[model samples]
Target: MSSFEPKIVTFLCNWCSYGAADLAGVSRFQYPPNMRVIRVPCSGRISPKMILAALRKGADGVWISGCHPGDCHYIEGNYYARRKFTLLKEMLEFNGIEPGRLHFSWISSAEGVKFAEVANKVIDEVRQLGPAKVFIKESPEESAA
Candidate 1:
């Protein structure tokens, strides 16, 4: 109920998490409405720049969801995503971004309940972290020495 409803940007695989999220909606599974989901062909399509872009665009947190490592629609797409996200996580932390501000999960197309659960969990964690002020861009004057 806080004024800071953290903006969560979720990149979901079209064949899995995206379908699962649609199922969650149809099931009327209650979840935080703060997530702005972007459906992609595969999680492998997600890039570090994409995640950082979402944060720069006002996302308080970011998530990338896909099929299980061995279940990616594009053979090993999820595996690739996993590796990329792992390295990106470390880079974000080293760059002054909070480590907890980004996350990743795997959800099958049939797991409507899981989609709702993950969505709620991500929102809760972000809420505890408060607003993503650090992710916000500073104006020219603010960044000026």
Candidate 2:
């Protein structure tokens, strides 16, 4: 097959990671255009269902980025996010999702360079995994046929 370009679903905490992504853009840092970002009020708001939905919708990978521990604008939000991410990641892996298909990170608005770096890393890893197979939802017509 031709070279694969994986589709990525990215969840960014509005106060931190989202700002960092915007900063990376303004700084002209280059990264792959493979990600579709969803901005959330805080990382703590992310649910396992959301991640699964992305995968089911045919995303090859998913990434969640939020404020560093102890630095959440919502005060303790990232703490909750950390625990949820840990457990959800493990569960997804146990359920047959490849370990490399999910990623998590902490990035502040001033860390534009770091944001670019992480973006590149995430894209590279997912590309290596090729197209997603499991849990992908077929279109209605395709399924009906």
In order, what lDDT does every prediction score?
A: 0.89, 0.90
Clashing pairs in 2: none
For candidate 2, give the lDDT of residue 106.
96
> Model 2, 1-145: lDDT tens per residue?
2588899999999999999999999999999999999999999999877887789888999999999988999999888988998998898788888889999999998899999999999999989888887664556755676
Model 1, 1-145: lDDT tens per residue? 4777899999999999999999999999999889888989999999777787788877889989999878887999999999999999998888888888998999999999999999999989989888876654545654584
**CA error at residue 135 for candidate 1, angstroms:** 5.2
Q: What's the lDDT for candidate 1?
A: 0.89
**Top-scoring candidate (TM-score):** 2
Error of 1 at 88 (Å): 0.6
- By lDDT, who's the top model here? 2
Compute each candidate's TM-score over C-alphas: 0.90, 0.91
Q: RMSDs, each prediction?
A: 4.3, 4.0
